[model samples]
Each structure stands twice: as C-alpha cells, then as structure tokens.
Target: MKRKIRVLVAKPGLDGHDRGAKVVARSLRDAGFEVIYTGIRQTPAMIAEAALQEDVDVVGLSVLSGAHMALVPKVKEALVAQGMDDVLVLVGGIIPNEDVPALNAIGVKGIFGPGTATQEIVDFIHKELAEPAA
Candidate 1:
C-alpha cells in the first residue's frame, strides 16, 4: 500500500494567531493526510526540524505577521539544509498578492489566502504530490 502523505503544518515567526492553522491541520487530517501541527511562535529552524523529524511530504506554513518575505525564505533555507528540498512547501494567510510570484519563485508550491476552501487545499496537495517531479 502507498504510504499516506505526511504534512507538517506550522505557524512560523511571531504569528500568534492559530485558528487558521488548526483548521487547516484538521482539514488535512480529515482528508486522510497525516498532519503534524507545530503551534504558534515557532522559528523557521524549529519548523524545519519538525519537518525533518516527522519525515513530512509537505510543509504548510501559516504566516499572518506580515513577515512572509523574511520568514518564508529562512524556512526554505532550513529545509534545504536538512536535505528536504524535494518536499512541497505551502503558505497561507495574510500574504499580499504582489508577493505571490516571489514566493513561488522560491519553491512555495501554493499560497492560500483568507476564505480559500479547505477542499481546495486538499485537492491541491493530492494533485501536486500525485504528479511525478519534472
């Protein structure tokens, strides 16, 4: 049997808000993906370490502190340092539209803003991870 997709959902930087993160974690779990939720106030290093230890297929970051430009890349760097460059990275919450392209350029596979459907996230993960890497 194929292994279930493992996802690490984290709140990076000083984002004390966690309702969205929790909701996404629960949604992913209900959709049959294994999810690990690292709570708020997590540093990028802490998140990367959790992803490595959990062997996650994806790292879902919830950043609402207006620090995406700074925090996301650091998280990506940490992941790469852990040799997790192949892992899918996703971001959600409070990201400006202008910054989306840059985030994508750095390997964030998807960015979901407020009011995005949970099912869309589930489907995105399914489709992205289902495809063979190019």
Candidate 2:
C-alpha cells in the first residue's frame, strides 16, 4: 500500500510569529498528510536533522523575516549533507517575486507567497511526490 505523504513543516530562524505556520500545518493535516510541525526558532540544522529522523517526503520552511534567501539555501545544504535531497523542499512566507527564481535554482520545488491558497501548497506536494526521481 502507498503510505501517506509525510511532511515536515518548520519555522526557522528568530521569527516569533507562528500563526501562519500553524495554520498551514493544520491545513496540510486536514488534507491527509502526516504533518510534523517543528515549532518556532528552529535552526536549519535542527530542521534537517528532524526531517532525516522522521524520514519525511517533504520539508516545508516558513520564514517571515525577509530572510528567505539565507534560510532556504541553508536548509537545502543541510539536506544535501544528510543525503536527503530527494525530499522535496518548499518555502513560503513573505517572499518577494524577484526571489523566486533564485530559490528554484537552489532546489526549491514550490514557492508559496502571501495569498497562495493552502490547497495549492498541498497539491504541489502531491504532484512533486508523484514524479519519478531524476
């Protein structure tokens, strides 16, 4: 039987605001994913470690402090270090439109900005996991 998609939704860096992350976590859970939410202030290393330990299929990072460029690459690096690059990485939270290309270049599959629907994020995960590995 196919296992349900396992996702790690994490808040990285010093951002104390968590209402958005919590809402997405809840939404993904309701959408039938096994959501592992690591609460606030998790470093990139901590998140990558947790993702590896949990053996999740996706890593979703929510950063609202305008540090998406710095945080997203660090998380990707950590995933590479752990040989978890096969795990899809998605980032959301206040990302500027100009920064989307750079995020994609660094292996981010989906970028969810403000006003992006919760179902869109969930659907992205579904479609990404369905693709055969490169």
* TM-score of each prediction: 0.96, 0.95
lDDT of 2: 0.92
* Candidate 1 C-alpha error for residue 7, in Å: 0.4
**What is each predicted model's overall lDDT from 0 to 1?**
0.95, 0.92
Per-residue lDDT tens digits of candidate 2, residues 42-81? 9999999999999999999999999888888999999999
lDDT of each residue in 63-107, candidate 1, tens digit only: 999999999999999999989999999999999999999999999
TM-score of the candidate numbered 1? 0.96
lDDT of 1: 0.95
Sequence-dependent TM-score of model 2:
0.95
